[model samples]
Target: MPLPKPPVRRARNKEDNELLIKGMTCALIGAVVLLAPYLAKSASVQDLMRQAYLVGWFALILGCAFLGRYALRRLAAHRSAPRG
Candidate 1:
């Protein structure tokens, strides 16, 4: 009897999926920023700005973390590649 084959993984498709997720994350962040003011009642302008800044910082950090990792990987790949 023949053994079952393992699943094949594609690198390009995984990269595309990561990009789509990053874009969607940005979109959701934008929507949240736009809706923040109207969503909070009895909140002062100062409070709203503080909340927005915190939210924005969190998103920025998360996105940058992934981007930094991706950039580091590409840099390492280039460093290892032979130059003509």
Candidate 2:
């Protein structure tokens, strides 16, 4: 009897998956940083958190952009695929 063949994996698919994971991680980190001020009790800590607020926003925006790019690529690929 012949052995079962393994599933094929494409490089583009792997890269797309990586992008999705990276975007999720960045968004999670940004959310944590953005909420840090509320969790701090010390005035100095809150002040630091305020300073880091811009960084959090940047990360969140970047993550959203990455997610958007991934979605667009997927949509384009789906649209271009031939129907049976």
Using TM-score as the measure, the top candidate is 2
Clash tally for model 1: 0
Worst 10 residues of 2 by lDDT: 2-11
Worst 10 residues of 1 by lDDT: 4-13
Give me the candidate number with maximum lDDT: 2
Query: What's the lDDT of the predicted structure labeled candidate 2?
Result: 0.86
TM-scores of all predicted structures? 0.46, 0.79
Query: Which regions of candidate 2 are displaced past 4 Å?
Result: 1-9
For the record, the alpha-carbon RMSD of candidate 1 to the native fold, in angstroms, is 8.0
Predicted candidate 2 versus true structure: per-residue lDDT over 1-84, tens digit per residue: 976754554988998898899888888888878998999999999899889999999898888888988899889879977575
lDDT of each: 0.64, 0.86
Deviation (Å) of 6 in candidate 2: 16
Candidate 1 segments exceeding 4 Å error: 1-13, 16-50
In candidate 1, how many Å is residue 64 off? 1.2
